[model samples]
Target chain A: MMLISAIILIIMIVILPLETGRFLERFDKGHQNDTGMVFLSGFLLQLVLFFPVALGTMFFIRQDNFVWCTRIYLILSCIPAIAGAVCRIRKLKEKKPAAGPERKAEVYKNTGEEKNGKFRDAEKTILWAAFFIILAYQLYKAVTTAFIDGDNTFYVTQSLIAQQQGVMFTNLPYTGGPTSLDMRHALAVLPLWFAYLAKVSGIHATVLCKTVMPLFLIPFTYLVFFEIAKRLYPEEKNNIPFFLCLVAVFEMFGSVSIYTSERFFLTRTWQGKAMLGSVVIPVIILALLMIAADIRDKSNANIKTAWYLIVSAGIFSGICTSLGVAFSALLTLGGCLVIAIRDRKPKLFAMSMLACIPQAVYMVLYVILK
Target chain B: MISRLWAYLELNIETVKNYAGTGFLLLIYAAAFAYLLISEKDKAKRVIFVWIPGLTLLFFFLPPVRWMYMKYIDGSATYYRVLWLIPVAMTIAHGFTRICEGFKLIGLPVAVALIALCGGDVYHSVAGPLVIASKAQNEYHIPQEVIETADIIMANEQGHRVKAVMPLDFTSYIRQYDTDLYLAYGRELIMRPDAYDELYSMLCEDPIDVEKMREAAIPRQVSYYVFPKTSGFVKDPESCGLEKAGETKDHVIYRDPEELEYMSGISYYYFTD
Candidate 1:
């Protein structure tokens, strides 16, 4: 069964997301986004599309037959991602994307590109050096501390249970039976998604939850940070290294900050709460930057793509954790209010607020749900 | 109130003094944040670089917010304040960017100095403690002896999980290896007494309250009583109507004379204090 599952996962993981990302890139201006960003955005979109169905399947079927329920949940979840990739391909024939690896992530208006100089190569070398140095330094802090914290135990137990029992929200870890656990059920299942993949891939749930997320997501997090920095200084190529330098050198509050996103990224990256703070918060910041750039550049078509990105992020927030969507709404509402009142771009504000609806709905569920 | 405030101020001063290098880096972030906020033009960029860090620093100063989190939330705001590190990182980034841009041709030298300065802080504030903790975690592992004993008992159990009462110290040692079985007294926050009430003693009070645990086992499920060979607990399994089922080199597993009731379901309440 494990071998069967592993064979299926190997094909589904990369190919589907790559095709989906390439197709999704079509809606953007000349497809002028970064390759990594497009891939992650497509992956995030797939996660958002498939989560509800996977969760619904897990709930009813899990009690009767756990193994098949897990297999069924995974199989059902892959459909939308695969289908969306195909549909997007059929829709977007041959207008090539000009983003990501193809070109530098766009600068906002015409502030002009960086001047060629002897210092430029030195600056980039220093930038790449700083990136690795910071990555290693933070990873040291993250990996060493281990999951001695409270919520770490909570999510570890949940993920482990999913791997062992092939069920969700049913078995208690200490004394096994149906869980009377109540909060928002939406917040409860984020760990299960990681567990599902671990189940099929034959990786231990603990290692996936602990090592893999920080190892992978933290680097992607830097990419997200770079995109935001690029949007901030679109033409000032010198600023790219400056942005990275900031990413590396800032250790603010030090160990005094017991619960910083840095701490979460290093130690608790696997948990839903950590994902919300580290991953989703940064994505929200990136979306806000893109929205600001679109309004400034007055690109209506790009504006459409940007709004779609925000909604996709919002949907991801719902599946990732309840707090993610709530934070998304708070960030969008705050950003929209700023743009609406200050920039007098009420249309942009209105559209951004509309984009925040999925997040708002998720927040409502968090508030009203039993 | 003034005296209390003075005491609080002194304590914080001491904390800052313990690692003055971090304090200095924090000061750099603050100064840069303030200067950049005043000088920078782009409000959008400033939000990421300036206001977020500034607001978080503002959160640090607000004693009421600090107190509420300290009192009601977790015992400290330090963990929740981890979010502030983002702003702090950006603020440091902001400082580096400003210095490099200011120096122009000499920016590389300036960048080197900044990295060195921050590296010093990372050493004192983070790296020193991280090395110690990492070493401790690597060196202190559970013995293979306990793990093998657990494996033998599990293999003999005919695919059914046996409920066992043992010392709480070895509970994690057993469960760490496998989860198919139950520990009547384990490291869970929410644990209820099994039918024989063997768990109430070791967990509820410090010394083993053997008097409370001596009641005979009730029949409805499988039950086992396990103890290490080095145990100081009263070793008579017959008191609880359990017969010695098996023994390993370091441990023994005792089975109930009759069937025992199964305990299942989430332990609804947990005691923290």
Candidate 2:
């Protein structure tokens, strides 16, 4: 399963860039509007990059097929390099600039924005300060909790033990039970990846893994918010970008601390799975919202970005605990529906309903499979 | 009134000293609010921001604050007497605000502080003397010895299985290693017995009678007996069969030969018999 996933990932990386380039060329020549195509192409590329790996992991685990899984995983692991190559190739292909006089005029017309650099610098400073402040705060919480309370000890210990046993999945050491007790159900996907890294590197994986989510989440959420802000106030004069970034950082810090602290008392154990879910669920929801807003803003709504968001949301929802998934799916569906109703766009409503299909299918399949 | 105000101030000071994280967070909130007020182009937004500091000041009057106040002012305080809800409530309020605003500014810092504070307690509970108390029986390795003795008797006996009356939670060790032992008496056998009555009966339950033994099946089967070595057991030996099998630093194991011989192949043992 892993091997299959790897191969699929590689194929996606190779194909997606070419597809995106084609879409962009069509848009530039007035064959398609730029707004919807850009979002659709980006969303499609991301889905193509990530979905196969996630699906392959799930399929292999559920079916208990390790052989093909190993092969698929190796192939998937090459995707980043493959993607880089594809990007370079596309860049080279685009190097022969169009020779039309209209193109030169368009290029010259777009270059008159030198005066905004000072404002951009000020905004950049505020953004960086806020980012660092939040990062420092998050680090302090993670470190103090781990040092004084040792929340990550169990995960670290389990990962170390698994590494020693030379297995990706194994029984937790303290359970002292039969061979039937597998702990894969307790650990999540990202933690498993981190544990694999730990096994290879011979270092504690929990802190690094825990740290990676926030780092990725902060930036990803920032991008989503930036897109939303850009659409909501197209004038670009408002400090929406700064505010959005500020909110993203704050939301991450607050959510992490609350989720961490709640789990600390409730389970009295430090497991990264719960924390990962809390962080991922909110970010994914926000991302989906932004995607919906983007699609709505476009002249010809990108059915593809809407589809990708729906599918990604469904997949993420499926991975989380039942109640969490339910809440998130409901929120995304409701939020999108509300926006569609308020905007009175049948296309938006249709897109939202289409997006919801993946989750409904996921829920039915989940029940059947379980 | 003056004394009360002094008491409140002293409490906040002590809270600052003990939980410096919270203090630092409060300072950040204060600074942010001050900044908001100074930089306010909007009158209503500035007023709203001012409430942030005011709310923090109000948090200083809660029970934990009162306890801290008493501790600092009069040097009298009990651990559990301190109100723990104030910080938790404030943190929750802040979290809600963050959620509403779709921004995390104040909520995140406050949460970090609270996690740091509560995490300290969790760590102390797990690794400190409380851990020692929880594992007193295991540390002395009484359960292992009991299981070994039971295994010896089971090898020699001809019965289906041995019946052993033991404590509840500690029996996991024997069950882990051995497959055919039955628990005749345990916490689950009697639900919420009076302290003295339960103690007296638990101490007295005999391990010899096959009819009296609780049957536990194989594969999922558990063997061996475990009981706490508290004071009441010594006062009532007939019920408990307080005979010394062996001694460890923390507990003593006890067994009765009559019970062992009944199922000649069956044996009963205890880590602290």
Candidate 3:
């Protein structure tokens, strides 16, 4: 099943870029001006890059050998992609023509006019108030619940055991089956890393580590909302940053409440922190969409950014939960197809297939391992 | 009547405290909408219309109003009784905003009143389920003996790899130990009287077909036997090889080398029989 999926994914990726290129050519010829084409082109590009990695891992790793190899492949693929994309984006920015004097004057004028607005001041006050209120509440709940719950202790102890064993799968007393430990879930890494740091810092770190997890969601929530706000209202960019901050506050509080109210729902000792990791998948997908939007805008034509987003999304998807990565990729592809159909851009539609190649590869690897 | 009202109020207060942040955000949104309406700024009104309703609905879904309602509502709180207001509140909020934006408005105090009414409806819906769950947890503390035995096993065990017999679904306890423990009778199989009778007959019948019984009883390897206080064999010790290992106020633990021998000896008996 995985092999077939991988092959289909690879085919989609290889074909998508060609389609996107065709769409761009058409657009240049004044055949398409719609934002839909841009979305399709970016989506296809994401598929092509992601599916191959998923497929490769699926084919190469046997079920017994899959978990660690999948994790390794995901991390290896993601880091370089993120680094490469960042470099390419930086290079692209440097190469762009500096804003003309007229554009700079306009930017200054807009900034000055915005500063004089009453609503802006009110919005800022609201945003800050919400942020602090949510942060303080989440922190309080996390602290109060940490000691009372045994699940955190179990996770910390198991993580320590995994670290000592050198491989995540071996010498772990808790896991009964032969499945790979490293492949368990990405959230496991955070507590394990905290355990390692505590060993170095000479402080009892388990409770601190568990307590800090919901707090991390505060920043993660902000990033996701920021990305969404940017995508939804790019021209009204000044308002987006503030709006994102408000959304972040709301999400942070919601997450904290859910965590405290039903601790069992969010984290199984074996699963580590499923909620935080799951939320990250959507955030990463949104970030990829933002990069696609940036590429389409001709603001910076960074192929590296495209590659980075695809690879990082693949790795994060692999690490978090196989299902989560699969769902996010599916959503992105679906979103892309909608854009393509709406815009009548065949090339962009094709590129969306290409962009999802790494995810396909990861899925393939996951199946073989399973 | 007063007590019932107090119970309802207590539930609402807890729900509000639990979801304080969401309430705070709704208040901000309400304030923002009020400002947009009063100022008569057409652009701001347009933006508020586009964003606020969707945002409110999204918040309602995420903190999950339905789940909250289910948690708090007693048997008395029917769906028909409360569900009518969901759309009504939504429509009222929508209409009030439109009217306020037009400045042919029903005054500032009325707008505030409308927002409060709408917010109150949402709050009531969410409070229904929170009360129910809170009451259930308060009422259903696990039996003390069960909890004590579980604690002892948890403390002594290294991981969920310990084997022991339990009267109920003890996987949750085994999970705490991080061990794979097998029940003497299969957890689900024991639930059926016919299955348990067949299993008991096989284990206790004279000139006991130990081989057949072992096959029936031990799906996984047998590590320990937990004989409840009520078991006839445990009450009259002469009928079985199992010797008392320990006893608690509600239950007793038994260990028998012959039982292990019986299980291990069954493989040989299988071919001979």
Best by DockQ: 1
**Candidate 2 chain A: 10-residue stretch with minimal lDDT:** A100-109
Residue A104, candidate 1: alpha-carbon lDDT: 55
The per-model DockQ list reads 0.20, 0.04, 0.06
Tell me how candidate 1 scores on lDDT.
0.56
Worst 10 residues of 1 chain A by lDDT: A251-260
Give the alpha carbon lDDT tens digit for every residue of B1-273 in model 1.
766556554544443344334455556656777777787777666655655444544544445544554564346324343233245555556556665663534664465466455444322334434421232132112335445556655666654566667655555445434455665544563333433344535523434333345342233243766656655545355564666667777877667646544445232221111
Q: Residues A75-136, candidate 2: write the lDDT tens digits.
A: 65445445644654675698764443332211122565432455555754665576566546
Report the Cα lDDT for residue B101, model 3: 32
lDDT tens digits, residues A1-370, model 3?
A: 5455335333332333334433333324321222333333333333333334433433344332223333553344344334434543564587874342332221333456433366645554664565556446545544443222334334554444333322232222232222333343322233433333333333333332443343444343344444455454434334443443333332322222332212222222123334323343444444445544543454544344444444555445444345544444544454445445544556655766676675676666555544
Instruction: Evaluate model 2: give its lDDT.
Output: 0.39
Interface RMSD of structure candidate 2 (Å)? 14.7
lDDT score of residue A156 within candidate 3:
52
Order of quality (DockQ): 1, 3, 2
Residue B29 displacement in candidate 1 (angstroms): 3.6
Which model is ahead, 1 or 3, in terms of lDDT?
1
TM-score for chain B of all predictions: 0.52, 0.30, 0.35
